[model samples]
Target chain A: MTTMMLVPGFDRVVELVPGERAVAIRNIPATLPVFATHFARFPVLPGVLLLESMADLAKAALGDGHWRLRTVRGVRFRHFVGPGDQVEIRVEVTGRTDQTAQVRATARVEERVVATARGLALVAAEQPWEGTQ
Target chain B: MRFHLIDRIESWTPREQITARKVTSVAEDCWRPTPAGPVLSFGLALEALCQSATWLMMLSTDYRLRAALLAVDEACAPRDVVPGDVLRTHAVVESMSDEAAVLAGLVTVGGETVLEASGILCSLMDAERLDDPADTALMGRQLLGKGAPR
Candidate 1:
């Protein structure tokens, strides 16, 4: 299993639509040091973290080979997701070429939409330090 | 509660523009892998843009309104930024209203545009909600920089 170094805790793959899409769940831990400083009283999860969660699921949908995000469009963040929330992330492969693929993704807390994004993902050779295991 | 996304304001023009920089540190990075070469994630770059826009909004409102990022469009990061790279972010206010403001932001390293976006920032609260307006203004001044003594 390839680990998500950029966005950790992406191991929970709930449903795989096979070759086209995937759904995963990640729990936001309240203990994140960010909460202590990000509006200490409110403690809402940063929007960037929410976006990263969706990007991680997009990577899982791509499956295999190193990839990079090239473009993200029409990202709309709705509800505020806070600590201890279990976010369900879904990603659908929209288009692809030999070197790149397009994906539309969303993050939800139950039925409430937390965020959505559409972006291009490109396959690239593993960075030399990634190691050939 | 400051996130410190922007280490220090490099330049500021009240309601018109702002430029800042943040260098990636292991303690602030989510990734820890060799060979990956200190990659800065796209999401983090976008956050830096939004943070800069937030400051522009706060300054324009005299620190009276606290804005939250409402939407991002055409956000493109053509290249990745390494750990040691100085991520310089520049934000220019396109327009502003009582409820929201539009901003054009670009992030660069060594004068090359690595990431760019057009984002909307909407005020979630204003001085009318705060008991002490001075407290908010104080923070506003801290971010906008002190004015010359009269």
Candidate 2:
């Protein structure tokens, strides 16, 4: 499977400015298995899943699926994302080097921001895992 | 497919700290296939750390409260966790109140640190609101090995 296909919560890339910025979306489905146990009575998308969405977008913005999340700084979740919500994710490259890229990311539902990561660093994997699976 | 990340609670000191373990397996849904091998996803590693911290907060509150992770001030992973690796997580309370708690956590494999996280903030709510108190108690018992093994 392609790296984008392996991204846990991402649906598709809506826009991409390679190595600069990117926007993606994920549609939360009620039938997702995680909801069954995250809270049987009340299901909300796990915060870590939201972070994964951001990391996926960060990798897209960096123009390399081989990039792996290395560090996270100042990530916060302000609102809950429930089933049927369409999360709009965006990532912008803040810094870059031959082996690493630093990014800032956000997730939103409509116009309200639900999550933000002030600093995320992605480092190239020693061996590109893509096309090998 | 179970959302409970940590497999077992090794030790806990009420309001002070907690230690837990998770044995990675190829069957996990979070496994990412790589040329090197299948490795646990970074997000799952963070979730395990958060769960460990949440367990400490819950035990400290006597199971009266449930914790929802609100912020991760800092986190870093130095190595990938692969199948058959036993992840040992240690979480310590930094500051706490009736509404929220801040903690620092680390994950190690065979005495070597694999991941480190600090300034984790979680919001506290009445446990009964999100989960049945009876079920929570039962799960706590099982995790701490005070109840029959599954």
Candidate 3:
């Protein structure tokens, strides 16, 4: 693949339940260079990255290249996930159509729900921006 | 880790509103390149919006508290953003409280809307302890167009 940029995709796809759902894990490194620049004294995983991880897991659950992330909604961060923390993502397909899929995803560190989000993924071939951008 | 997504602030009004820009360049930090042209990742675009919201929170609170992105109620980017395109974002305060605030905004290239979002940002603790003074001062100078911060 194109080496899933920024925050380096998920560490591994721990489990995949076909089109229904997937679970993945990523261990945040304390030495991540961004942490040094994000804040000199204190650092926390960027909230957007938390959402991105969820999206990646959702995509994994979908399987194949037929789908790609399109929109993210109702995502909320309940706690700060920092360096050395292990983020476990669980994504479930809430609904689907001929060309699109809706997923509800959550990220937890240990037993605490750190973040949650709902998103839509469009089939690669049918995505609005396919080849006409 | 320290990639500053928003290039600069074009305009500002303390807590009420603000406008910023991100200049896409070939040397930009990205995870991968594609044949589809300058595709600003959805995550990066979302972070840009969140940065603007954070700015509003900073100004509105008189720099007393640092704001963290809490939630995105809704968001969409209808088109792909390519190189040489300047992203102009305008964010406004929808509502506010001591603990958190609602922000609404859009990202446009030229005159076409590329992305739109509404979200919430929260002030969790004292800004003094959470923010780097130099970075904070730099942002202030940029918003006021005082060159490259002191």
Best by DockQ: 2
In candidate 2, residue B68 scores what lDDT?
93
Compute DockQ for each candidate against the true complex: 0.43, 0.51, 0.49
How should the candidates be ordered by TM-score, best one leading?
A: 2, 3, 1
Q: Best TM-score goes to which candidate?
A: 2
Judge the docking of candidate 1 as incorrect, acceptable, medium or high.
Answer: acceptable
2 or 3, greater by lDDT: 2
List interface RMSDs for the candidates, in order. Answer: 5.0, 3.7, 3.0
lDDT of 2 by residue, A42-109 (tens): 78889998998898778767876577787999999999999999999989999999888999999999
| TM-score of each candidate structure, all chains considered together | 0.83, 0.92, 0.88
> For model 1, which pairs clash?
A129-B35
Q: What tens digits encode model 1's per-residue C-alpha lDDT throughout A80-113?
A: 8878888888889887765677888888898788
Model number with the top lDDT: 2
Which lDDT value does model 2 have at A90? 89
Q: Candidate 1 — which residues are off by over 4 angstroms?
A: A1-8, A123-133, B30-35, B121-124, B127-150
> Candidate 3 regions off by >4 Å?
A1-8, A121-133, B31-38, B148-150
Q: Write the per-residue lDDT of candidate 3 for residues B14-103, one digit (tens) a residue.
A: 768889888776666653333444466667777777777776677667777666778888878776666667788888887777777788
